[model samples]
Target: MSKVVLITGGSSGIGKAIGDYLSSRNYTVYGTSRNPDTIQNSLFPLLKMDVCNLESIESAISELIEATGKIDVLINNAGVGITGPIEETPTEEMKKAFDTNLYGPINVIKTVLPYMRSQKRGHIINITSIAGYMGLPYRGIYSATKSALEITIEAMRMETLQFGIKMTNVAPGDFATNIAAGRYHAPVLENSPYKEAYSSTLKMMNEHVDHGEDPSKMAKVVHQIIENENPKIHYKVGAPMQKFSIVLKRILPDKVYERMLLKHYGLK
Candidate 1:
């Protein structure tokens, strides 16, 4: 039997791409969205699930289990993007981001682990961001959320390995997706101290997304990871420089790296 795969936030964007690719390859794929009915012409079935809602996650997982009898893989791809100056961003919004990006995925993992454990074999691939490796100006909250998830997986992967379940993170760089459309943006108040700088950085961020690599590339990398016998703890997919930035951070001095980031963001 083909492996049964569950992907959260699969209505569109990267999740949809993955689902489409895997389905074509004969994997049993089901995706989750807040409103599955609204999505038309989906390549795979999408269950109604809000990662921030434990009840909904449980319901969706139960339904999938009932239908497939086993979940061979779980992809925690549901997340939101938040961009603003750390101080200027609303505390409530930041909490919401953490709830969806961090706690949300954790809850989904909690719900699926029992089944995966029972099967004694499964894979959990988290869709993290390359930005998680380093803090970027204006997009700090988004970075923190993904970074925390990355660290959490590092610890959880070790614990879950004993059950014959594998967990890994695939951090993708800017992908050409509708993420920018959904991201929360703190209004650019004319009088706010960060008005000019924040506005410029925000524009640059959107441009990067607009010209980002195809989401299909990310799907291909994920397919490879699922096929691997001994997958690494972390894998990054993006442009050469984007991936290299992570390495630069490791070798460069703290201040030097910070300076480079500042220059890159045109904040210097």
Candidate 2:
């Protein structure tokens, strides 16, 4: 039988691209969205699910198992972006980002683990961000959320290994997607100290997304991870420089790296 794969936030963007590519390759693919009915002409079936809602996630997973008999792989691709100056961003907004981007994926994994454990074999691929490796000026909250998830997986991957289940994080750089439209952005107050820097950084961030690599590239990477018998704990997909930044952070001193980031964001 073809492997059964479940992807959250699959109605569009990277999730949709993965679903489409995997479906064409004969893997049974099911994507999730808050409103599956709203999506039309999706290459694979989409289940109604909200990662932030535990009940919804349980229901969707149960329904998927009932239909497919097994979930061979899961891609936790459901996440929201938040961009704002750390001090100016509302506490509530930051909590909301953590709720969706961090807690949301954890809850889904909690619900799916028992099933995967019973099967004694499965793969979990988390869709994190290249930004997760380090803090970005205006995108601090988003970075933190993904960074936390990356660390969580590092610990959980070991614990779950005994059950023959594999867990890994795939951090991708900016991809051409609708993520910018859905992300939260704290207003740039004209009088705020961060207004000038935040405004310019936000504009630059969007332009990067507008000219980002195709989501299909991310899909291909996901596919390769699924096929690998011993997937690494972390994999990054992006421009050479974007991937190199992670390495730079490792080899360079903290102050030097911070300065480099400041210059890159035009905040120096």
Top lDDT: which candidate number?
1
lDDT of each prediction vs. the true structure? 0.96, 0.96
lDDT of 1 by residue, 1-268 (tens): 9999999999899999999999999999999999999999999999999999999999999999999999999999999999999989999999999999999999999999999999999999999999999999999999999999999999999899999999999999999999999989898998999999999999999999999999999999999999999999999999999999999999999999999999998899
What is the alpha-carbon lDDT of model 2 when measured against the actual structure? 0.96
Query: lDDT per residue, candidate 2, 71-108, as tens digits?
Result: 99999999999999899899999999999999999999
* lDDT of model 1, residue 234: 95
Clash count of each predicted structure:
0, 0
Model 2, residue pairs in steric clash:
none
Show where candidate 1 strays beyond 4 Å: none
